[model samples]
Target: MSMDAVTLPDLSGRTAIVTGANSGLGVETTRMLAGMGARVVMAVRDVDKGREAADAVRGETEVRWLDLADLASVRAFAKEWKGDLHLLINNAGVMAIPESRTKDGFETQFGTNHLGHFALTNLLLEHVTGRVVTVSSSLHRRAPGIEFDNVDLVGRYTPYRAYNQSKLANLLFTLELQRRLADAGSPVLAVAAHPGYAATNLQSHSGSRVQRALLAVGNRVFAQNATAGALPTIYAATQDVPGAAYAGPKNMGGQRGAPALAGRSEAAWNSVAAHRLWALSEELTGVTFPLTSSTG
Candidate 1:
């Protein structure tokens, strides 16, 4: 199925917040939601870049500062949000990168791509009663799983492996979030999606020059443009999707096509891992999501 063939539903009176909205898939997602009459918030790390992207969009949208590398920034952004949020797209992430740490002292890729968003999502859980979209990746299948002993990737950090771990964490987070929401009978739906080799600036983080060159070539040969790549995320965020559904392009190897239900790794479906991750996430982020027994 071609991405262009899919039709988006009207989003009147809806409110959406898209992280990393300054460019690439995030910009396109914001544009589409705004075009459908949704009030969109471009949650960005840089205000200037965000304004430029927001100005390019054809519908109503606003920009807000949100640095996923900084826990304080995530908390501040959540506190400043004032109304009900129909969609929360955790779209921002770091790709392959050299070993580094966020201001919050987490490894760069895992921190920004997983833990930071985890904190942000929990902090804003009160406002997001409709849907939450976590952008994962096909690369999630590369890593063994979450390294519970060394989440920060302390002494053994290979760029791709670290990124793979983060993406796996994303899927784990989504599934666990859905379970908790269901258990509590909350109105919020948790889903996961991937762009499936979208041509974006995310590769700039690669630590190796050779890896970056390889990525560039791969993108040129196979990657879809940002707009086409954003469909799955939009589908997860806006469609009448079932809880815990995973969306991605329905194409060869799940790349460059319309969004549809996609497959997840066996480990991603582990309830025990999800539960453990959830508990750890709550402890690490210092944010407790209220779960009631009535719905479980």
Candidate 2:
């Protein structure tokens, strides 16, 4: 697919929440959504930074505090939400940082990237009238499968390995969320997208200095700008795509270009694991699918 092929409709009356909306892909996604006349809530860990970013975004926009690594913050944000949400963009995430755990004692990567959005989505599901678009990555393919027995990766921890597991969890979350929504006969869609080597600050935080240095060079030389990187997300958000559809760049083996329906690893297609993950998420977060009886 080409950039020209994916056009957005007038989103004047719609409302969207883009997490990590202070910078990079999140901010770009917020800009595009607001430019199209949607009311965008810029959810971030830092309220001040979010305000600064929101100031640059033209059209209807607001900044709200949300620390995805902390479930308390996620619950607070969801509780304050009053109206229907047209687009819930799970765009906030951490990259390959050193081994750490969330305030809730979960692996930081999985906690913020997958579990946080998992809780927020379920908490806000009743109010979501349109779609849920989670930002994933091509790195998800690196995961063998979720370390169900040792989710935190414990003694076997590695930065990239944990990152991969979290990313894979993102896709599996989408898969199960869509299945539950379908079982409930809801119109809302669940989809995932990857920025595909976007030149974003996300790479700057890699645990290895050597990796970070190399990624910095790659970002300048090969990666697409944030605008192009945010396309797959924008495409997944507004397009009439199917549930669980994965979108990413269509060129250079998904490293760059326009958004298209991208393929997933065999593990990403594992429905059983998807369900198991969903159950585990609920156990960890104390949040269940809103349409519980129907989903079961």
Backbone clashes counted, model 1: 0
The residue ranges of model 1 lying beyond 4 angstroms of the native Cα positions read 1-5
The 10-residue segment of model 2 with minimum total lDDT is 1-10
lDDT winner: 2
Alpha-carbon lDDT, every model: 0.88, 0.94
Instruction: Give lDDT: candidate 1, residue 119.
Output: 90
lDDT of 2 by residue, 62-120 (tens): 99999999999999999999999999999999998999999999999999999999999
TM-score: model 2 vs. ground truth: 0.97
User: Could you report the Cα RMSD, in angstroms, for every candidate shown?
Assistant: 1.8, 1.6
Give the per-residue Cα lDDT of candidate 1 at 245: 91
Residue-by-residue lDDT tens digits, candidate 1, 168-256: 99999999999888877798999999999899988866868888899899889989989888989988887778999999998988987
Clashing pairs in 1: none
Each prediction's TM-score versus the true structure = 0.96, 0.97
